[model samples]
Target chain A: MSTAVAHRPGLHSWLTLIRCEAKMVVRDTAGLVVPIGLPLLILVMNASAAGDEEITAGRTALDLYILPLVFTIVTATIGIINMPSFLAYYRRSGILRRLAVTPASPAMVLIAQVVVSLIQAILGIALAFAVAVLAFGAHLPVDLGPAVGIVALSIAAMYALGMVVAALAPTPNSAVAIGLVGFFGLGALGGLFGGRDSLPGPLATLGEWLPFGASVEALSNAWAGQPVEAVHLLSLAVSAVLGAGIAAMFFRWD
Target chain B: MSEPAILAEGLHKQYGDTVAVDDISLRVERGETLGILGMNGAGKTTTVELIAGLRAPDRGSVRVLGLDPRRDRGAVRQVLGVQLQHAYLHGALTVVELLELYRSFYPDPRSTEELLELVELTGQRKTRFEKLSGGQQQRLSIALALAGRPQAVILDELTTGLDPRARRRMWAAVESLREETVILVSHAMEEVERLCDRVALIDAGRILASGTPAELVAQSGAPNLDEAFVALTGKELEIEEESA
Candidate 1:
């Protein structure tokens, strides 16, 4: 074989990969239902439950709390639960190994998954916000800037943790099991079902230090028009860095 | 003489205590089809992977088109196309979509329509990979391997799961790529005899024999390549028992 100089293409190559990945994500309707459908369902249900009941010193209602919780569930479901299963399936099926021989590195696939998950998270948030505003007459955040910042940081932290699960799980089934454990375990600590103060003193203290708890606190504070605690933001940033570092150190291409 | 398209010397690979490839060396000229023939657990797959840069040898040097597979992996990828045994693509992607995605990796890729036609997948372009039959999936894989217009192509067990008719069709598609340096890893003696310019017979991670089909047949004093393979590897009794 003649050894011709290998051609190096630009960004177009990765764009194609991302497009294909997005198409596959769209086709997986069952997977999308949880991220998109569950949030809308929760929004309507929680809004009905509040029904003219004033929560928190007559200034806020249960609907305000539900909005943040719905946002958490949307980001966590896509970032922690959905992303790992897709990546693990790719690894178990030897798709990563196959891509190693081609000009495209397998890392592109991971980027594609992250991109699609972020898109889903954004869509889920948008749907919840629209429903809350139209049907429940919910007030918008006092400062959109900090609210967006908190949401972005929360997504980064959650996805970083998800990458760790994807790196360690040997199979798709194992990925799902581990991801669900992380989801519910973190969800409870973050007060997805109830107030974190309701938990025992030690558990509440531990939750305060965890990424999910930090994210919930930051988002809840932002939605309630209160200044977010600096420690919570720092914890989320720390979790994002540590979780991503661990995942990168142990990631396997095959 | 021109440099060999692929050269490997003193290859040794092991898994735990089991040796997968032991002191095997090979060279293939440009545009030559070299068949690696071996029985089960004979390390043919490992040898191909080493050559393709998918696996690094425990102790060996492999050069493809004058570049080290490990050190020059990016360059090697630009020139090498591989279809691993029992490998898969995204199940939800349609055949055309998968082809287009792979084609984007290469600077000068063959048109997707042409590739679909070459693999006889024109009629099934819109079908998802999971929905396609076994033969169709295999053909799509072969087409994807050729998407880069690779100078060297490695095909492992290309027709293992296909029906006889599909196998013949696959053979024809492979035959069309005769100008590329192709390393075919297979157990089917007839396929090697029909398509290979040279053959390497491996047994227990070692090369038992190497030559053309006629040379091997003549050396073993056998009626055909199949019996000659049995004679060379000394597996005639085991094969006979299995068949009986």
Candidate 2:
């Protein structure tokens, strides 16, 4: 309560900004629940339903497919829905504009959001894996390297698209609206609900080139102990580059 | 003599075809509170932004603490604290938490407790920003602007929505910082008279008059600053109808 001022060592503004943003993310129930809850829910529900179904010659539904689709849902839910909503809220509330006048640039806030969302996505993936192993006795991926690579690449691609939504949406509600559309539309076309083959001729061809569909295919292959497809990996990389580039070019502070 | 804490010369800004601030020159000496009095859309906020380096002027130059505000923005931010009219903090952060976070941006900052006490927000330390009353929020915003222990501060529309009691408390808090240079943008004549060492009356993106409260009163041949403001601005009939 004393009016005397004190001098303290200066901390890097970006670190302080990231820590504050992380605290806000933890307090945000809706932001946390969607990325964490929805993926776990899908994992348990799908596991229970696929009790004894064999999708192929020797592979059960849980063994080679459900986990990858669950991973897709995790990445898409965070990158396409949660990230855009949080960023748009910051923009609309003038928090970003306020930071512009401080020593910290608004880009630090964007980086912090991506970092926190990635951490949440990883936690979601780990929880899904635990449930898959214990409740369903699903086999682990033969090689962890390729599986991890596909997951990381997919997340990068999805989050890049999320940045596009955050940059373009004029308001928080519009960002959420655009995010949800991207989530569901990509989920359907990317074979998160089912196999890509089930889609019609033109749709299946188009979905094959999309980052979501490419990621699902690459993840499924890696999980099944097959080498990752070059085209799918390329598509995902291209999507990440293009999406991030566009978002960076068009982002507005106010 | 030390240079003025803030200096702007022939500053002009426009949005599309409409001029916001036109050919305005201002100087605020150290340890002085210069009140910028203007009606709504009088370019008071725009002038503040230009001095704070938040907006680049279409023409003219601005220097803050002897450094070009636009080119030395990073250095200027180190000593220039600004509380913008529409700026907002995160709603979920507690008062103390927000203060501490802002404190980290400066090498020398006032303690959280002191800032809260100065603004009479010590009792609301644990309250979330969204939970605070409008007056409390305004107080917190001011506290944030002062957190860096800045040499100069700009407060735009600082007491616009405050109740009379809250406005008095704000004035007292601002009064406590009399040793630091301050540029206050306000529409309240009484606030300018009580707190400002010198006042500038701006209208339609131009400064109409600049002097102490008494000088302005005498120049306008009015008994008080309120009537003097009206007389000088030629808005006497409008003021009478509004007050009536």
Candidate 3:
């Protein structure tokens, strides 16, 4: 009998897994387009109107309000909606269970998926920025460092919530349904439909504390050359931690 | 004596009020093919799942290649390839792509072309998993199990839904793996009789008998292993018609 133990999967294996994941994400037409297309549509529709309304020295309402909202939409849609559905499908279809038996652990799938989703998110963000600047003449954020930092935090925060949705959802359809509820629930309160000013006082306050509201507010502050509030940052950090904790506790591979 | 490839001692598992596995013990020597014969819901799949470390036994131990499956899962996974009853794979991946991905997971994996030829899937190399026929999908699953060049392999219901032609082809694939330790879980007596060196009859989460096919027939005073199975387990073997 051969007594040789198998070698651990190397970088080549991970790259192949990630490539497969990327292919799946690309092939799913609706999933591929919606996260990028919907946000771009919203950005274009709002950019022309917001472009003429200058908020500070040179930056318009486009930079402070519309750009952040558009970027937030990109991250939230992909992180909260697309990523979880893929995870739910993998679990439902037993793909994760199948990988568990191989030298390639199932955790590798999750990591590969996250990597692909991050790449998709980056593409969406870059596309939105390109259109905003080239097409609508939008300017960069006054505080570029913080704006970039906030967007990264928002991505992490949204992905954490996506993990929770993937954990609780029994099927892909359920994942989409729950993700939509989450995206809109947070969006509506976070000033997606309109600014939080129009919401009920309590809801507006609640929205300010949620990832969507917190991200938009922080990004808006950074764009407007103002200091981001500690409260907004705290909201995003807490959501990320809590969402990860819940997912780790309840997630099932199959 | 050389250590056995697989050993299970008094394995017991339960789900809620249902006892899925109960006090089952087995030992499979290196390079030996052991057939586990049982009807549906006779804990066949559950038994293999325990050996593969997919589920932790409630009250026993399992070791593969002298390593505890649960404790040494990383090492065991390197040597133990499992083909479950379900064809659980990414639906959109083509046969070759899936084979390539699984191949990359092992340091010494069989080439995609080699696996495709082994399962007679060369013609369907570019075909998507969901697009393959049920038999073809089962064959692909078997190929994936063999991709890692595992020393110990477990195939659960390998040909359950296959047509006779496909079943014969699958048997040929198994025959080529005679050098590896194999635990074949199936309801098909013909498959066991042809491929396995020894057979164990199980019923209601317990082993009814264990011996070579001839020995099983002699012990039960039956005409063949099929009749021996019925006499030992007190259950009629129900062979489903070929559907794919």
- The 0-to-1 C-alpha lDDT of every candidate, in the order given, reads 0.85, 0.84, 0.90
TM-score of the second chain, each candidate in turn, equals 0.96, 0.96, 0.97
Listed in order, the DockQ scores are 0.65, 0.44, 0.61
Candidate order (TM-score): 3, 1, 2
Question: Which lDDT value does model 1 have at A235?
Answer: 87
Candidate 2 on B1-244: residue-level lDDT in tens?
6678888999999999999999999999989999999888789999999999889999999988887767876777778888988678999899998998888778778999899899999899999999999889999999999988888899988887778899899999999996789999888888889999999999999999999999999999999999998898887412211110
Residue A65's lDDT within candidate 2 is 70
Q: lDDT per residue, candidate 1, A1-254, as tens digits?
A: 44566566458888888888888889988989989998788778778666366554332454457777788789888888998888888877878888888888887788877887888899999988888877777766665689899889989988988988988887778989999999989988888777889999999877877877888778778866788999899988998899899999988887
Identify the leading candidate in terms of lDDT: 3
Candidate 3 chain A worst ten-residue window by lDDT: A1-10
lDDT at B187 for candidate 3?
89
TM-score of each: 0.96, 0.94, 0.97
Residue by residue across B38-134, what tens digits does model 3's lDDT show?
8888899899999999999999999898888878777888898999877479888889989999999888898888899999999999898989998
Candidate 1: where are CA atoms >4 Å away? A1-3, A51-59, B236-244
Judge candidate 2 at residue B61 and give its lDDT: 95
In angstroms, give how far residue A183 of model 3 lies from its true place. Answer: 1.2
In model 1, pairs of residues that clash are none
Query: Candidate 2 — which residues are off by over 4 angstroms?
Result: A1-15, A51-59, B236-244
Quality class of the docking in candidate 1, CAPRI style: medium
